[model samples]
Target: MPRRASGPRLYLDKKRRQWAIRDGANFIRTGCPEAKLEWAEKLLAKYIAAKYSPPKSASPPIADILLFYLKDRVPMMKSRSAKYNVANLEKFWGDKLLSDVTPANCRAYARTRSQSAARADLEKLQSAINHWHSERATLPAIPKVWKPPRNEPRDRWLTVSEAARLVKASKRAEHLKRFVLLGLYTGSRAGVLRTLEWSWIDLEAGTMRRRAPGASEVANKRTPPIRLPRKLKHFLRRWKVADGGQCKYVVHYNGQPILRDPWRSWKEACKAAGLVGVHPHVLRHTRATWMVQRGVPPWQAAGYLGMTVRVLEATYGHHSPDWQAEAADI
Candidate 1:
């Protein structure tokens, strides 16, 4: 038996070193050079839309709607995971029509992904549909994109002793040490730390700006400026002199920015400290836990940690000695 023929898809023309759309025996050139893959993808989306998208009043193929959203909306997103979420969603929903988004199908999608991950992916789907609807003057009633229940916030945080051991173990690697210290003291997410530059640190003002200039400000993943801890300030000052003001990024290897997470060195540090299953984000959790244990006010701690007060209280408030003191007295 012969294999079935595939439909229009992206193909690299190795001879010309450019992207093209393969449609049966013919190739439609994208006019996009090798370096401009995103542009090629956008052009391909236009091709798919022109060919497969239904009339304005009818429900459209899931792929066409998603591709339209990808072309129009995703470019403005601040989240790094947006493209991956869209790709995963496309895999399951590509051939399906918008009318097929039923509760049963949504649950099937959930079963294939982790609880939290499924929720996130479905949320993206929901957003894409909403975006599509908003742009259209008329269409069928939007199908609901069901999602799994939200998972409880993770409870894993390090003890003071464990944090100390991890930091000490990290001392073997200069970049890892700085990464750990900044994570523990400032409670910034790993992404912020990865992109942190020396220019964001203000030793004289005793503050550190977590967000890069001109980066889109995301409400959920806030990156508010925080005052530097006295100890952390001293470390930064010393590191500045040691680096001789040559490095651009704070968490750099040989004065060059790390293109990816320092997972190998981080895992080694964790192993040397006799810790397991403790990823980098745990350091931020540990800092929040410590502050709550010390009876820090939720608003103040939330501000310093670049999270909302409601989130801080919901996740770590129980650690406070005075938590529910008045209510529990009964």
Candidate 2:
């Protein structure tokens, strides 16, 4: 008996413990039984057809490409901020083809939305298109998207006295005091804190495990635990003792977790503290600013705040007392 020549080679992959089909340089692994040569051939045919198939058009629908990109990229996104980008981009340009997305189209989108929103959407689109092109080795000429001027990072920060005032004022609102304190001390986002469970916190160890809800701890690279400040730890101790230490969440109202927006209570606390335009996120800014002002290293501050060193430098570098101080000596 002689071996028959086939379109592509087929063999058993010992490492994968599966039958594999080789299409030129590409290998497709399948769980088909080794004796099932007919199934392997069918799979190889499908794989080769899909792999070598020409694009339906020179430029497919932008929406189609965007969908593909989102399918691949969304899972890797560790923050909820990407949702805004996805929504905005799809809303404006989902129907258009890649070739039809012109500078004017981008400008029109920008005009309809704010420049910041346009910038975010276009940047996401650009990234998606770039990835698609890289995968297919087809680089189509694309219009340049205009980006809005980057605004100066907000410098609003609360002094220790101001923070104390806000925390004290928030005591009137159930759970707001602890929320404010945790925000100011940990620099964790409101969403993270709101869905936080008792299991993640370690009072004796003086640490709290932090990660975006529904995100995989092992898969997500961005969200990580933040150390509890001594003040926050002490506050938590007292809070736990008072609450009988049985509640599932750290911030609760009348034995229930505070899951929804706490805007009313936040506003009241801000007003009482005489702070203007302050929000939950400002507590994060305040914490980062305070850390930099107190001479904490940029890397350490970034780690504590669950951001990168580049972001730390770009946003809060100016607040660091040591930053650019040597220029005066020169």
Q: In candidate 2, what residue range of length 10 has the lowest lDDT sum?
A: 49-58
Using all chains and alpha carbons, the TM-scores for the candidates as numbered come to 0.84, 0.71
Per-residue lDDT of 227-248 in model 2, one digit per residue for the tens? 7888788888888888886788
Candidate 1's C-alpha lDDT? 0.88
Q: Please, what are the lDDT tens digits per residue for candidate 1 over residues 129-148?
A: 88888874245688888899
Show pairs that collide, candidate 1. Answer: none
C-alpha lDDT (0 to 100) for residue 92 of candidate 1? 96
Name the best candidate (by lDDT).
Answer: 1
> What lDDT does each candidate get?
0.88, 0.77
**Model 1 regions more than 4 Å off:** 1-57
